[model samples]
Target: MHNGFMRVTALALGIAGALAMGNAHASGFQIRENSVKNLGRANSGTAVAKHDASVVSNNPAAMVNFDRSAVQVDMTDINLDASFTGGGTTAIGTPLSGGNGGDPGSATLVPAISAVFPLSGAFDKVTVGVSVDAPFGLKTEYDPQWVGRYNAIKSDVKTVDLNLSSAIAVTDRFSIGAGLILQRADVTLTNAIDYGTAICTASVPGNLGASVANCLNPAYPFRPQANDGNVEVSGKDTSLGWRIGLQWKPTDHLTIGASHRSEIDHNLTGKADFTAPSAVAAVLGPRVADQSINAPLTTPSVSTISVEYDFNDAFRLMADYQATDWHSLQSVKIFTGGGGVLGNEPFQWKDTSFYSLGGEWDLSPAWTLRAGIAKDESPTNDTYRTPRLPDKNRKIFSLGATWNVSDAISVDAAYMRINVDDPTINGATSSSGSHLTGTFKAHADLFGVAAQFKF
Candidate 1:
């Protein structure tokens, strides 16, 4: 084979080994932690509300609401509580052993920042802004010896985004905006494998090429010699995307806004590390060598419509409906440049929608309180639930307050609790002769704070 083809084949292992784990969370790994104010409103009005510069990330057109240069910084702390129950998680080789895969989720933090500046001279009607934050990620870990270890042990994926946007008001009541997005992504995943199950692929006597059913099959001669091995993969990639938004006000107390974000395509390059037990390595060492890998992924796109209405001077309400195009990850295929088939995972994910309603209370000249509720649906199905991500339909309840110390300095804080429905996983088939099954109970708490300064 040519040197270039060989190099690509070597890297293909990582993608085949870890892609499942990397793209298994939040209805296929989507995140919404851009603003503390939005969090307080269950992300409602993100496309129209202009509480701070953070609006630049969701709806640049809303930046026209600001008259001066401003900077906003926000941070959110997440605490996840998740665990698996049920049975039939036994691996192929190891006797049915280990405990429930403790907490499958991790406590993590997400941060976001944005700055907006008004135009001058001839550009007086235009506003420009920049935003930085993470858009997608999940971190889940399990005991190395857990019953589901053969399926997943640790899975992590993260993405960072930088956006530059500009907006112009075409009329007193209408505005248009667009932004260019630059994003970087990284992933790592680990899992155990059954050596005996892998041997079924060998062209030897008593081998079952396509119907290998672990050591339980009487057709196998050395089922007792089965041993467990491990595979680890890590990779990174960068991609570009775009977003556009519009804002309109037909009445004094009501504003209508909409935004759409394009999807980013990523081609990641990385390496896979295989650690085989002595018995298995003696014969399969060459096939299990560390190799360079490539994984192709397309992040989801989103379209959101928001409405902000003021009942009177002291109360304002905002509602939103957002649709996510999770169909981008409909299925996944992994293979080497040399025509070697590593694995193919069938996702058949469905598109999902989120609905939110929030109300803001203006208590005093400097104090404002906010509250909201949201319903977030999951795209995953029971037939394909995996240990890497036990996602399900969820509800979010939130509360928040803003304290304006002065006209130029204000701080916002919000709290949210997420409740997830308990979902059951009907057995899911893995490579060779492995199948994994279980049920998951998951929930989380989020706390966010943001500081805004108008210059």
Candidate 2:
């Protein structure tokens, strides 16, 4: 029974991964970009001090620099593009229809919002603030004719976070801050394919192939593919997490910062829908409860550190490092309301780290220029990797500037380019020895703009 449950869960993740074809993982295909200022700096803030609302993610300690009560609002948009580089159809009883790679479907309209407002300063320069932000999200789609449809079609993940924080300047050169994180996340996984092509194969034992085709055909008693019958699962999870940070200005011209957030365990609540061929449903549906399956959500952890250097009068450098415990995502286990196993699957990910370095140059009294570079490692293993994510290590280049509209306001704009190294997966297989091997390339471009207000 435990093995059966595990298999069912694996199948569920496989389905989920398929729908989230371009980007989905233990972190749920989400980006860490939240504030316009950080985007301009390649998200590097481990060290320098800033008075912007972006302090919510950078270093809450930096918020101490803001004197008056202030509020800042920000919005960001992300665009992603991905394409399959190499992979051929499996002829060894492959359970997929159609040919190889197709058009690279695109996803857009990704929007994020965040706000910060400071309260009374009780301690030396102490300020309490509340912020809401989208810390992570993903959107990936593939052409209907892609041969990997059975493994993935379209996958989307979204997350909203609320943080209550406080920061104080302990000394002229030292500051500290902390935040209580409340998180809400949602995931949707979908896969659509021709039932006949998915389950029928001439090499199968007995007359199963003939039966599969006959039952799934449009003219037959069952028309599962008529509307491109799909399997879908949607769920939401809520979790509690926390972060602590410190900023030290050791010298008049240098600054340093560090921060950490603890992991949160989430109990997700959601539903699933499975549209199977009538003949197959008749045999499997009775054993399961319905045409659907449901379960709890997964939990993951993230940690980051950053630093900056202020040189001369208006020039500074930035660097950031982040680590995500993807290894904790080794498996996804779903639970029914009664504590029964609904589904579970292996994620088989390794702990991963990301590094970024950037610089901010004050081009003029009213204009600030930014540029940065970053490198991120992949967490997926070759054997377990599939078209859904087809992930690889990547590099990012970013540039931006803030125009001082007046003494009290500024507008920031940034552009970023992402490049993924081609990844290869060999010896992919089905339980029956069916094999798959391929190479994949992933990339995307993002343009961002945000306005900041100060009083």
**Highest-lDDT candidate:** 1
Q: Write the per-residue lDDT of candidate 1 for residues 1-455, one digit (tens) a residue.
A: 01111121212222222322222223446778888998888888888886768778788888888889999999988777877775553334334456887876666788999999989899988999999988787666788877767667877777899999999988889999999999998888777665555564344333435333535666654342256777776678988999999999999999999999998888766766777777556655476677766667778889989999999998999999989987877655554535454555566678999999999999997999999999988877887665555577888899999999999999999998888888776775444245556677777888999999998
Residue 243 deviation, candidate 2, in Å? 1.0
Rate residue 416 of model 1 by lDDT: 87
The C-alpha RMSD in Å for every predicted model, in order, reads 4.5, 4.6
lDDT of 2 at 408: 80
Model 1 error, position 317 (Å): 0.5
Q: Quote each prediction's TM-score.
A: 0.90, 0.84
Q: Which residue ranges in model 2 land beyond 4 Å of their true spot?
A: 1-28, 46-49, 85-92, 99-105, 110-112, 115-121, 193-229, 279-299, 336-342, 427-436
Candidate number achieving the greatest TM-score relative to the actual structure: 1
Model 1 vs. true fold: TM: 0.90
Residue 264 miss distance in model 2 (angstroms): 1.8
The sequence of per-residue lDDT tens digits that candidate 2 reaches over residues 291-334 is: 33454444446677777777877888888888876665666776
Predicted structure 2: clash tally:
17
